[model samples]
Structure formats: structure tokens, C-alpha cells
Target chain A: MNHPPTTATLLALLATLACNVDRKQDDVPATDPPTPHVALLTSGPVSDAGWHAGAYEGLQLIGDSLGFEVSHQQTRTPAEFDEAFISYAEDGYGLIFGHGFEYQDAASRAGEQYPDVTFVVSGGSRPSANVVPLLFHLNEASYLAGMAAGAVTAAGIVGMVGGVEIPTAKGTFVAFEAGVKAVRADAAVLETFTGDWYDPSAAKEAAAAQLRQGADVLIHNLDAASFGFFQAVREAREGGSEAWAFGMNRDQNDVAPDVIVGSAVINIPAMFLRTATAWRDGTLGGVAEYAGLRVGAVEFVPNPAQEGVIPPEALARIDEARQAIIAGELEVPRIEYLEPEDDDPPSP
Target chain B: MNRTLTPVLTATAALAATLAVAAALLALGGHSPGAVFAALLRGAFGTWDRFFSFTLVRATPLLLTGLAVALAFKARVWNIGAEGQLHAGALAGVAVAILLPVHSPLLVLPATLAAAAAAGALWAAVPAAMKTRMGVGEVITTLLMNFVAVFLAQFLVQGPLQEPRGVFNQTDEIPLAARLPALLPDTRLHLGFLLGIVIAVALWLYLTRTPGGFRLRAVGASPRAAEVSGRFRAGPVVWLAFLTSGAIAGLAGWIQVAGVTHRMYEGLSPGWGYTAIAVALLARLNPLAVVVTAIVFGALSAGGGAMQREAGVPEVWVRGIEALVILAVLTVDRSWQVLAGGGSRD
Candidate 1:
């Protein structure tokens, strides 16, 4: 009855509002070639204070140190990947960092469209002429941290609590187990995956289960869930049991300094800065850029408060192993996920 | 005439009030409100290219799901399982498109879409059967089904449906022949938008013209009244609404993958089904108006990104503004109804 007129009015009102709100086109002033602009896109919020936060810090570092105009967008869905990439490229962003493996496909498509703009994806697989994968070899550091865990464990049992059993997370645990065996051949090792990267309760429960099974030292490869993992170890100490934990992904030594023996950290901000600097100098190749102990982008940082938690001999062995890994003499166990480079085949 | 004029004036007042509040919030957050709004408008509709590529592309899923929700709500059927149905549709579509071994574009596309629709209908059948046969409430069943569907999708993608390489937690890209054809050249807008528009028009016609539509509406108004006066069983009409709504929603899922992503992933939907409730409500359960309301929400989404990019507003702020606008609109609509002596419908 009256609904027809009401609907008509609604449409007319929307039309008028849209027409009135047309953005003024006179804002842009003709300017000669502007400074190179850089942008970052993350599927999750940067306020997570771990993986995404590290990337955000890296973007800021590039802006502060390299003097490039930097911007960041927290994209919600896969659909937004292409939209964000195109929008930034259209707005004259010279370099854009899509900070996840999920971005590789979208980055590849956007790369083909905007060949002039370089798109970098952290933990990405595929790489094209304009798409670069920034691979973080944090397993190298995790191995050293595992050596420390092996030495510090009073029960001769160490555990690894990981978030998601993806190749990247699994690689860290594999290398850690290897490092533990290298230190204590008879040591018992345990591993558990929470199947999530952000569920704190799940991570805590996993860590608690490992501790209850006589594991004195634990290392975790989780993001936001690391807090819960550390809480389990801290709670063990409160229960009058000797427990120590290791942090992963970023330098989290201060997060739970008392219970944490050390941390396997990927210097994400530094790696981002180096990549942006290379892009600016036109030296950034389409090939995947591996950041590891050799490049000083990954390291095992000992907690200052937990001094001498790792025995002297064990610390020395960790240092030796770190050197060997950097020299390519020691190969830390890692899951090879990246597609083989097409341009340069591996020598048989 | 007075009835229509009052509601329209109330809606206009609501729009002005919401904008004023949004401006104040933006200014409080240390952003220039005019600049932020300008950036949002520019990002959503400044260019023909953006309108087609971003706005319409985003609207395609919303439009389909909105129609599904509108139709169900019109019949007073609480089909809260569109999210699950959409996922079931996507999973079925992808499974058929990838494994069917049919390379012909015509055959593969149609078969894939039909499978999706069937899967969605099947998913809704569970809740429908629970409600009709067991006399169970659909609200809880449909809502719970969403979690089950999401976890099932995650399991399939991580296990059986994983890419050949088994590195990423997603399915392999569907064949090129299965991908939706672009509706507009040089834009991300696909045939899905056209499909959605056609569906909306068809649904509008059905609701306004058909005898079956009248029965459904009569039952929706009051099942007892329909049974007494129209002498038609409300049960069959309710079943029809649920199945049809589920089928449309299922199309939305496959259309998204067939059109845009080209593959099924864990987070296939960003809660488009949940958002569809708001879309349907804002359109007053009218199928045709859902087309416009869906686009309005699409613009908000497209512009939300720009607000972050151009105005330096955080995603939280943008989301908050969106919620505020929706609340304002609904409040005004309700207040007008009450003032006109109609009271609340629900």
C-alpha cells in the first residue's frame, strides 16, 4: 500500500545524498615525480604485537630510516588483497609488502598489472618479475634455542608447542628436535600443535600438557598465543616445579623474562628495511630473498634476567652450531615449501 | 500519502543525525571529517572503474545473500544458516568444478553452479526438517550449523581439498573454463553481479504477482489466519521459503569463488551471511530494495578501506562508524512506525 511510496522516497534520498557527496576533484595539484611511496597490507591487525606487529614496525622503520612515504592497511578478506594492491599501486606506491603467504597469488596478479611497482610477500612461495618473496629462515635460530632447552632441562625432556602445523611452523620444531639430539642424545622430545595461531587458551593447554608429561623446558612457535604458552610455564614455576620456555618469531625475551630462558627471533623490521633499501637501489631481484643467521636477520637472544640458565658448555655448543649453520656446514632441518626457482635449476 | 511522507522524513532525519555523529567521532579521533568522508566517497564511487571493480564486485555476494535473507524473513522463517549454506555451496561447487573432468565452459559452469545450489538446499534441509518434523526451533539449529560448516570447510581445505603442493591451506584454483566470465571489460566485476540482479528482479516479481507468493505472505502474516481464511497449508509454504532461500545463498558462495577468488579457502566468507541480515532488514524485506541496500553496504565496505588508506583511520574506527549508521537507521525506521500508530511488527 504505502510501502511503494516509502521505497521510492528512500531511493530518491539515497540518490540525492550520493550526488551531493561527490568528492571534489580539484584537490590534486600537478606535481613533478614524487618521492617513492611504500605500503604494507596484512590480513590481520598489526596490534597483535607479534607477527603482524613486527611487520608494522618494519614498515615504520622504512619510513623513518629510508625516507619513503609509508602506509599500511589491515585487509580483512582474500577479496581485499587485490583491491588493496591495485589501490596502492594506482596511488603511486613504488613498493608494497603483503605480509603473509596468502598474498602470493594476489600479488602475482597485481604484479602483472603493475609491472613498475614491486610487490613483496613475506613467507610467500611464488615469485615473478615484479613479485618478490621475503623468506625468513627462523629455523636456524630455533635450532640454537633448542640446544639451550636441551641443556637447561633438568628432566632430560624438552617440548615444542607450536601454532598451526604448517610447513613454516613445523620446520622450526623439526630443527629444534635435531638441535636437542645434537646436545643430549638420550633426551626425550615432545611436540604438539594447537592448530591455531591466535588461540591463547589452546596454546596454554598444549604447553600445560607437555609440562605435566615431565618436560622441564619448552619452546613455542606461536604468535598471540605465545602469552598463553608462557603462562603455562610460569604457572609450573608457581606450582614449585622448575620450568623454562623459549619464545619464537620475534624477540620476546622480555615478555616473560623470569621463566623464559631465551628466544629465537626473526628480525622482521630489519629484514623489511633491507628489502626496501634494495628496492630503492634497484638491486632487489624477483628471486626469493632469504633472511637467516648468515644475514644477521635471525638470532637466538638469551634473556638477561635468566642469566646462566643454559650451562656454559651448552652455550658454547649453541654458538658453535650457530656459526656452522651460517657457514653452511650445518643444515638445520627445514620443510622446503617454496617452488624451485625456474631461472636457475639446482645443480645435480 | 501521510504514512509514506512521515517515514521518508524520519529516514532523512536519521541520515543527517548519523552523519553529524560520524563527523564528530572522526574529528575526535584527530581526523578532518570532511576529508575522511571525501576519501570514502572517492574510493567507493569517484570513478567508473572503482564503482564497477570494487563496489559491484563486493556487492555481488551481499546482493545474493540479502535476497535469500529477505525472502526467508518475508515468510517469517528464521533461516540463520545462510552462512553455512553458502559454504556448503562453495565446497560443492569447487568439488564439482575441480573433479568433474568436464572441460567445456558451458557444461562445467552450469554443473558447478547447480551442484552448489543443491548443496546449499541440502544444508538448509537439516534445519528445515528439524523445525517442521521435530518441532524444533530453527534459530539455534541454523546458527549452530554455521560453526559446523566453517569447521568442515577448514578440515576439507586442510586435508582432502588442499592444493597439490600441500603447502597452503586452500584448494587448487578451479579450471580457467570454470571461472566466471567478466561482465565488464578491464574490471573485476563478473557475471555474478548480473546473476544477482536477475535473481532480485525475479524474486520481486514472484512475491508481488504469483498466487504462491500470496499464500506465503498470508502464512507469514499469520499461519493460523492463512489456514483458516486461505485454506492453504502453511507448512508447505514455509518449506518452500527455506529451500529457495538456501538455494540463492548457495549461489552466492560459488559465485564468489567462480567470479573472484577462483578457489575455495578457509576464510571463504567474511561473515557475508550475518551481514545479509542487516541488508535485508534495511531493505524492509523487499527483494528489489535489497539490490540497492546491498550496494549501499558494498560502498561502506569499499569506502571503509579508503578511510583507513586515505584518512589514516583505523579499521576499528571504520567498523564502529558502520555499526553506528546501521543502528541510527533502524532506530529511525522503528520510531517512525511507532509514531504512525503501527507499533512494532515483530
Candidate 2:
């Protein structure tokens, strides 16, 4: 009896077809003599001016400081993640930064294939021998920002707008909520997750919803969506309302100098350079790199334009909390979203 | 021989033209064209492991979606909502995977797939009913439904179907029982690829051998002529095409989730549904041909990543090259027809 070709046979034929083509070996050496090549893969465009921009700057900083050949690509989907990792590793890129938690799975897979290449994922949930999660503990700074929001809210109401309630984002809000309550015990807090990372309209609508509920101070953990939050707050103040916003992730105070009180920032460039240095020195990887206020990586930077807007006591208390957090006297709230394999559902 | 060779010749012309144009662009952008091309080829098929794991694994969904689009276009039904139908199926399949009481792989897998297909068909039925009853166009209806489906998926991941912790907007992974087994011993390629091939072969046989398929094609070629000459009803045939296309697309969604992703998340597709149109059209709406065309697209996508990684080419440029190739394909195919016409006249 004649049988049709099975998938196994067909796949074999496809590979054979590919194999038949004459191939040229890569003549370019994997790494140049003096410096190793580095790359960054972002899920969003670098022009996003938030998450992706910060990473792009880090890539540039690494290149400028280390004299390495640096490049950046805005990858859209998970399928591209493996390809980017494998390609970079094959080309002798010593370090590749996938600037989001989403890169963890693909990074680990590629890390296994190329043992020498170091893959660093920002806000990543997992860590491997070669794949290291560069955890930016911004929640500690958000806690301080929450204290500032609590101190300055004229209406005694504050709002927290977020993009996708991932554990990292949630941890910031959780710490912020705790910090707000600590400063103003009677302050009413409102929370909304826009369920997006880059939708400005949705973020604007969410901020507006919180403003309409009488939130005089707003803070957000959105990426490019942060623009909408600031816009909504600025419009609220222009419309004769007493509303202000704190910027989250990177120093976004200059983005909206008039309305932004302060920024809870993660100094991503410094972290990338430090990580790259460690890799160069053969002392990086195999564990999570927790960058927080202690390492001078995360901090709450006050807006220069609105210098005196925060009362002296609030600023002093914020400084105190910062010291306490660094000294282990104050413990900020955090969420361990990363799971071990066994935590997943059991096999049938 | 002349008839069979025409498509091959046109395809070859399209590929060559695309490469020439792309090489110029790459050179203009300060990249070595030879290096980039070599990187692209190696990325797609450099190793047996890459071919099965990267190329074929990526091709699986494209093949299924291409077949769906080809089947519908064969009957002159424009189903832009394959994206929405796919999402509908994924949502339903995941819901069943999580909520169903059955534990056996045999029972659970089939039931989940059935639910996905039904959900996909139901999603398509909305546009089909609107087109048949109100005489509204299916193109706009189907396209609009995609947005609704995406929003619905977003809501499900965030709200009711969310993972227990509720930290992120994604569903929990389905049980091991529901997952499609790996086709290769140590590769990521799964049973879904085989399923896609089987479906393509079956569809080709149905389109060529079945009476219903003939009636559908007749309606597509000319509805009025079909009704007068062949005594075929266009309405039923169109509805059949719409629903069947939706069913196939829905299965694609489920297979992707069950075979690869193992969970439902936003942006799981990365616009595979929209890409299927080009895949189908490039194959001239032939199901068997879609299999080949889909693999070509799959290789392009897989290679695009490698180009970015190996040649330091930006992803946007790789995407630009891909679009250029598709454009070249359509143009060359059209020009080949004119050339053939000139040859016939001579």
C-alpha cells in the first residue's frame, strides 16, 4: 500500500533542500580585536521615549564607554526573540540585552546554545547560568514617590495608574500604596490598570477617570503610556483643578516640567555599564542582579522646576526613608512573580 | 509542462528581483549584501535543528492560516476576520483546557479542538449572517470583528480567565495532556505541523474532487453564471466557505497555543492572520500550493531575525525586504501572464 509522506519525511526533505544550497562561511571574526560587540532588543520602538528609549540610551552608553560595537533592534514578537538571541550569539556578540521580562524564556533557550554570550534581561523573572535577570528594584523609589504624593495631595486623594498588572508593576504600586498610607493615614487611594504598555489614549482615559474621582496626585508605571497620564494631569490643573503627577521609570520630570512633582527612576545606563564591566571581568551571570537605591541604580529624583513644591518636612522624611531602605531599617513591599518549574501545573 | 512551469518561472523571477532590490538597499545602508544574504540563508536553514525547530515550527501556523484564507478566497469569500476567528478559537480552546473536567489526553485534546472550531465558526457566522441577511459587505465586517476579538481576548486574560495570581493579563498554561507532542525527538516542532499538512492535502482533494467544492468555485468565478448554468446557489456556498475558513483559522489558533505557547496571551499572533492573505494569494488560492508558499514566508520570517542578529541589520529593514518580496511576487506573477499572452499570440 502506498502511503503519503509523513511530517518527519517531509521535514527531512525540507532540510535536505536547504542543505543542497552552496554556503559561504562567515569570514568576519565573531569579535573584533579590542572590543566585544553588544546588542539590545526592545519590544517597542526606541522613539517611545520611555522604556525602550532608556534601553537604547544604555546600549549607546555601553558603546561610548567600552568602545564596543553596539546595535539595537525593535523586535515585535516572541518568535523573533530566539532568532535575535541566536543571531547575536552566533555573530560573537559578548553581551545581548533583552530589555523586558518577556525576553526571559527565549534568552534562556539561546543562552544554552551559546554558553559564552551573556544575555541580560531587564525586569526579567528568571535567571540561568548564562541568562541573568537585571532586576531594577524601582518599587523602593516608588515608595518614596508615594510619600511625596501623600504629602502634597490637596484633596487627600491619590491615584495609581498602571500598564498591565505584572508583578513588577504591581510591586511598585503595592509599595506606593503602602508609602502613601504611611504618610497620610486618611488619604484615599484609587488604582486602575490600563492593561497596556504603549496605548496613550487608554492611559489618558484611565488617568482622567482617577482625576474625575478627585485624585489630586497621580503616579503611573506605564511605559510610553505615561504621556497620557501626565497629559491628563496637566489638563486637570489647567482646568482649575489641583492635580499633580509623579513620573515612574527613568527621570521623566523633564518630560513635563510644569506638572511633574518628581520622578521615581531606575538609572538603566549605569546598570548596563556595571553589568557589562562585570561580564568583562568574568564575575557576572548565574544570579539576579538586583539594582536598587543601595547601588545608586534606583532613586527618587525631585523635579528642579518644582523644587520647593514639596514641603521641607516631606523631602526630609523622604531622605530619611531612602536611608532607612538602604540601611535595612525600612523594608519596602515586593512581589516575587518569578516561578520555579515545579510551580507550574502538574503533568497529567 | 508549460502550464506547470509558468508559476515556477514567475516565482523565480519574483525571488530574483526581490534579492536584487534588497541587495541594493543593504549596500546603500552600509551593509555587505553578500554577508546579509548568507546570514539570512543560514538563519532559516543552516542546520537540521534550525530547519525543524525554527523554520518548520514557525511555518506551522502560517500553513494553517494560509489554508484557511485560500479555502475562503477559492469561493470568493474575503475573510479578513481570520484573525478574529483565530482569537475566538484560542479563547474557547483555552477556556476548555482550563475548565473542562476531562483528564485523558485523548478526550481533552479533541474536545478542546472542537470547541475552538465551533467558536471560530460562530465568530465568522456573525459576518456571514450580516452579509446574507442585510447585504452588508463581509470585508469590513470581518476586519472590524478582529478588533473586537482582540479586546475580548484582552478582557479574558485580565478578568475571568486570568491566572490565579492576577498579576499579568495572560491565561495559565494548559495541562500537559492537552499539549501537542513533539514530532522530532529533541526539537520543538510539534504534531500541529503535521495536522496543518494533512488539512492542506485534504482541502486540495476536497476542492478538486468534491461536487460541493465545484459549486463553491463556480459561485466564486461568477455567481450569476453559476446559478444559471450550473444551477448552484451562491448563498449557501459562500456561507460554507466563510464558516469553514473560520473553523480552519480557529484550529490554527488552538494548535498554536496547545503546541507552542501553552498559554493564551495578548499579541500571540503577531499578525499571522493578516500575513495569511499574502501567503494564500501568492499560492493562487490553491491549498497544496499554500503549504509551499507558507513555508517560504516562514523561512523569510525566520531568516529576518537572523539577518538582524548576524548582519547587524535592523528588524525594520528585514520587514521592509519581506514586504518588497511580496510586492515583487504579485507584480512578477501579473507580468508573467502578459508575457504568456504575447507568446500565445506569436
For model 1, give the interface RMSD: 7.3
lDDT string for model 2 (A1-348, tens) is: 111233235345435433443344434553454678889999887777777888888889989998888877678767667667766776678899999888877787677778888999998866777888998889999999999988999889999999987888999998999889889999999999887888999999999999999899999999988888899999999999988999999799899999999999988888988888888888998888989999988999999999888999999999999999999899999888765533442221
Q: Candidate 2: DockQ? A: 0.24
Off by over 4 Å in 1: A1-25, A29-33, A340-348, B1-15, B343-346
For residues A1-348, what per-residue lDDT tens digits would candidate 1 score against the true structure? 333255456567556655555534356433233778889999888899889999999999999998888888889887899999999998888899999888987888888789999999998887777899998899999999988888888899999998877888888999999888888889999999888889999999999999999999999999899999999999999999999999999889899998998899999999999999999999886799999999988999999898888888889999999899989999999988887544532111
Return the lDDT, model 1, position B84. Answer: 93
Residue-level lDDT for A343 in candidate 1 = 51
lDDT of 2: 0.84
* Per-residue lDDT value at B79 in model 1: 89
Alpha-carbon deviation at A91 in model 2, angstroms: 5.3
Model 2 residue pairs with clashes? none
Q: Interface Cα RMSD per model, in Å?
A: 7.3, 9.5
Which parts of model 2 have CA positions greater than 4 angstroms off? A1-26, A30-39, A63-73, A86-96, A108-119, A128-131, A340-348, B1-5, B101-103, B342-346
